[model samples]
Target: MTKPTFDLQSHSLHSDGVLAPAEVVANAAAAGVQLLALSDHDTVDGVGEAIAAGARHGVAIVPSTEISAVDGSYEDLHVLGYGIDHRDPALAERLRAARADRELRAERMAQKLNELGFAVDDAPLAARRAAGKPIGRPHLAQAVLIHPDNAERLEREGHDDVSSFIPAYLIPGTPGYLARTHPTVFEAIDWIHEAGGLAIWAHPFWDIDADAEVLGAIDRFAAAGLDGVEVFYPTHDAAQTKLLADRCAALGLLTTGSSDYHGPEHRLFRTFLAHELHGYAPDLSKLEQAAARAAEAAA
Candidate 1:
């Protein structure tokens, strides 16, 4: 049997992504991904445009979103919802609330940086978001780098992405840190279900340790109605990948392989896309079936 090829995770400018939804679909077609998902952050605002473009490009676009999530044990985990009804009112309301909070947080972070003498202003950030992009730490970092003084300080580094600046300033407990929140994993899973979607736990190894403690945590996630786990992320080492795979199989959970393609616009784009060099592809038949099932269930 031929191996399936798909890239189930990507982003668009509707969130923190650089590419428009249609442009992302076109690029993914060029990269040879026949089936793709534009899982923008917290919004499905781009999915309609992407679905139209996917039809033109002959690539199937999965309408999806990556929901920020929190758990008692995990502060910054994420949940990937596939086959979502992007127009669902409840989902839209939740995302609106989150975006509103993020706006306030970005404003506070900018004020914090201004007080700390970075000379950063909220104008550029607000303007960038005026076009309907997510107001995120990256947008703020880009705003900071726009300052000639800070730009000169970061000049020798030659970095166009915000990877370096985020940890330097915006991480939790850092100077520009603002406490953001997400629904608990349980609540996020319920939201996905409500949207007639399949909720997959995104990148479990992010903060999970390899121990009985982590294994116990996995069990808790399974109990929370997570349909699958992202076992084939680029960051998962060979052993870690196998560990997640084993856990998924043992628990009878669906398995997914995704590039988590953030596109070339990201400062960290070089990092995640590098996984493609290591040969990352997903089983499209499985993904297609899952999408069909979710669509029917949603209908």
Candidate 2:
């Protein structure tokens, strides 16, 4: 099979990604990605900029967003909305609410960190909030890593990378962990549909809670109107990828592929158009049909 040229999941500084929207497009174009989705977490604010950059760089931009949602017994399960109307008022409102919730979670996490003696500076976090950028655990981790008070402790504890802080302190059952109060996965799927987009479960393998029950969760999500699953990902082994692809086929759901690129500075899954996804070509006809329907509905 020919390598897939489209990456359905990515991020920008509009969310947790370090690079700006145009920078992400330029990087994807340089990596020979023909189609790129600027699926920032909980916001499409960067999609317009990314689309313009794509036009300039000869790449197609799929207006998209990665919504952080939950299912029963599954927390922080991301749902990717592709080919969305970036300007949809209802979608914007819902995303705003989600981002607000994220801010609250981040704040609570920071407080917990402080209580645990891992103080986080409030200035940078305040600046991010002031600039309308989403507050994520990464930002908090950066704060923790950079604080003069925590430097010796972090170095002594062998926590040199931002990624190390996440599992150690910010995730569930940790000292700084704070539960998210975001929308349910089903509600997120409905929001994506209302905005004229296809809702796909993003990176099932990354969600530890859902990993063991991938096919079962796919059935549940499909029943709740999920349009697809990200069948090809950098972390998924051949067996896992094939399993997801076969299940998507059996269920008549779209199977998508992506690098889930955050940025080059990221410690893991940093490559755009990763080689792991090159073996499987995603059937984009389904996506095109969905886009056509969306356009017709708009018209």
In terms of lDDT, the best-performing candidate is: 2
Residue-wise C-alpha lDDT for candidate 2, range 1-299, written one tens digit per residue: 56778787888998889899999999999999977788999999898788778778877777789999988767799999988888999999999999999898888888899899997888889898999999998899999998898989999989998899889998877788878656999999999999988999998887853555988999999998999998888888888888888899899999887898989978886888773653566678756554444334433
Model 1 stretches with alpha carbons more than 4 Å out: 1-4, 155-160, 207-214, 265-267, 270-286, 290-299
Each model's TM-score, in the order given? 0.86, 0.94
What lDDT does each candidate get? 0.74, 0.85
Model 1 Cα lDDT, one tens digit per residue, 1-299: 13335767888778777788888888888877777788987788888788778777877767789887677745567788887788799998887776777778788888998887776756777676787667888778888887777666567656445888887788766787876666778887898889888888887776666656556767888898888887777677777777777787789877675677777655444223333213333334656865554344434
| Local error of candidate 1 at residue 219 (angstroms) | 1.7
Best by TM-score: 2
For residue 5, give model 2's deviation from the true position in Å: 1.0
Which stretch of 10 consecutive residues in model 1 shows the poorest summed lDDT?
270-279
What's the distance in Å from true for residue 153, model 2? 0.4
